[model samples]
Target: MKSSVNQFSTQFEWILNVINVGVHIVNKDGDTVFYNKMMAHIDGLDREQVLGENIFQLYPSLTDESSTLHVALEKGIETIESIQTYVNLKEKKITSINSTYPLYEDGEIIGAVEIAKDITKVMSMYDQIVDLRSQLAETHKKNKFFEGTATYHFSDLIGSSPAFQEAISLAKKAARTHSPVMIYGPTGTGKELIAQSIHNVSAQRNQPFIAQNCAAVPKELMEGLLFGTTKGAFTGAMDRLGIFEQANGGTLFLDELNSLDLGLQAKLLRVLQEGEVRRVGGSKEQKINVKIIAAMNISPDEALERGIIRSDLFFRLNVVTIQMPSLLERKMDIPEIVNHFIQKFNKSFFSDVRGISQKAMQRLLQYSWPGNIRELGHAIELAFNVMDTGEVMIEEHHLPAYLFPSGKYSVSNAQSHHPPLKDKIDLPVVLEEMEREMIINMFEKYNGNISKTAEALNIKRQGLQYKLTKYGIEKVYAAGSKEPK
Candidate 1:
């Protein structure tokens, strides 16, 4: 009688425990030896229904081919957490993530126990978080500009004035459409920067972005540089691919468009219109899929009227025009530009120049900069050369003498400090000294190009010849001859 009472107590404990949601089980030959209420809740099977049923028959989704249970059974130590979606006996589909572990008895495999938590809500929340994170990433990417080649976007353009903002707005709109873009702006107004930003944000971001100044190449070589030439087209000519071909499926930023002679404008127009270019000394025309972004200070209409640019090409290039505002017009950004340049120069030159002074800032503001941002950059560089302290207290004296009262704006004042007769030397001798320095400097600047240096200083051939004689500058560099005295 005591044995029977003990057996009854053991049976009652097992039966009561099965009512709770967690399933405890051992199956031999696909028959459940133990069960829990949790397992019943997850699978929607009563303890009685699951007790003697084959595991695969009850959950048909967990087969040897497609189930984690099979892998655990095969490996004997594998655990798998998987989600299974199936229709219940009531025809309602249910999804449950089951974490199955293999059960062993007496160092021999018996079956597996699956602990499943209702992860539908968890999964739903996880998906929402992922979506929100993606949106946040996109927002962060959009807000961050100039961070790198990949991070730039249209929203990062900083400008408040209508003129500046309107140009950026048009650039943004232009980026969406795949068409030729012409940026009109004076030098150093960030034309190339704007072009790069546009290219970065455009659909062709992954493609090539090639920039070339039209004026930098010789006029006679323009055709060969733009369109490849066949072998033996010219002396020492080996078949070479031109820039246009290399920039296929990408952008080609032709800066200084006004510098290209009118003869080449017709050739450029053909490429824009027909999407084809015939190589110099080659008859075959090759189709090139390239987007153009031309930059020039001169207006297309003005160039067309002056016969500097072909009228047809002007129309083709003027499809979309973005006019970059001069830095003077956006004086509000001067401080920002100054700070940016200071940081940049500090890094580049390895100097500890912290910031510009209040007086220096005022000087920059009051000054009418003819050279624009380029001149400002140069001035900062010059200041670094003269700077002894960390503070860049750029006074008017720190500026180029030409930019001061002693330059083009010089006017005689009686009270002004005047040098004595010795200081006011002979004009001819002074002119000679100036000419010597200019010739020496310009020669170096032009890399010994007589025509280029002369053209740059806007002096005639005979005039340059006269100055060369007056200063006794060398006509042509003989290997060991003195350059200038």
Candidate 2:
């Protein structure tokens, strides 16, 4: 019986080592009892050195408070799908999603086992997809214009709200200088439109106006794209001019700048500071004069907190800053924006949809546009596609199905409980009430933790606090505070 048990244990160990997923086992004393080949590879460690070692001693960076395996072993608890980031003993930054559970023998916890899936590659792929989409959009937009002309100008910006006007004013001022400009706003808030307008009005308007979204390309591709590649750089590599060389004596608009890796960002900062770029696999550096206009869909402060943008890079790029307000903050401009889109689609689709009805407009205003102006444009386009040929006015029924999922609202039903417009219902006040209620609800849902509440609402912590103060509401807890027990 003893000989059979020993053979079974050996076979089990071998099977664990052969599995694809990383597996790590530690005894109750936190001594490594089993460390599979897969786990060793994932951790960048040798299997022989890790086996029968003290896990804490091997990984000095990990502690009882920081390690899931230690926690599970000491507490006999299970942790599922928890994301963990750490610097390995090799000093490599590693990110993985892990599941750890206590190992039990005869109703007593004897050890802990961790199953891990490294997500570094997965995250890199996701970043590439994000950058690719942005690049594709810019390419499409550029194709619509004449070879070197910018499609958007200051006059083409279609909003009358003070918030938007202020952003445009700042952009116009930024265009006059040779300094780098940083534009920050929520997604779909027309950051690209503003950037293009600045380029068209700038000193380098006649020169090449190249645009690249930092997140739109993989790191390897991005390096080559920004700084030219040499013939011997890699297999099938030909001498190529990067964006910096292409846009010399012109403007290079880098959208989603926060998506750039920190290391790449540092290189970009050096280029900006030194006014030069060196091609990959090339020895000599070439002088270039490229005006960089970087844009981000997230607030600069939030990006800083998330480590998406390097502090030194941001300071260098933020010589001029433009903050575009979201559609919600500038709701008064929706009517004009909608009208503009209607005319645009009419010309594009050959449909003469005159305008949107007041009822439909009201429904649009009521919606919290998570996608901002872009979503509004899409909704209008969708309505036009489904409208009848002779339909002169867009009504509630013409709107997208998702906008009114419950059912279409009749004009009478919409106005049933509302006072007559002759009484002059304050539109701003009503909107403010709705906004305040949303903030309060999210605040409570997050247990008054300002950071979590702000994240849930997709706004900056400063913005949330401003709203809270505007509404005369007090937070139950401070930012980053834990929930009440």
Clashes of 2: 3
Instruction: Candidate 1: give the clashing pairs.
Output: 20-37, 20-38, 21-37, 21-38, 22-38
lDDT of 1 at 417: 31
Q: Flag regions of model 1 displaced more than 4 Å.
A: 1-159, 389-396, 407-485
Instruction: Please list the C-alpha lDDT of all candidates, in the order they appear.
Output: 0.63, 0.76
Give the deviation of candidate 2 from the true structure as CA RMSD: 13.3
lDDT of 1 by residue, 261-295 (tens): 78888888888889998877788989988879999
How many residue pairs clash in all the candidates, one count each?
A: 5, 3
The predictions' CA RMSDs to the true structure, in order, are: 28.6, 13.3
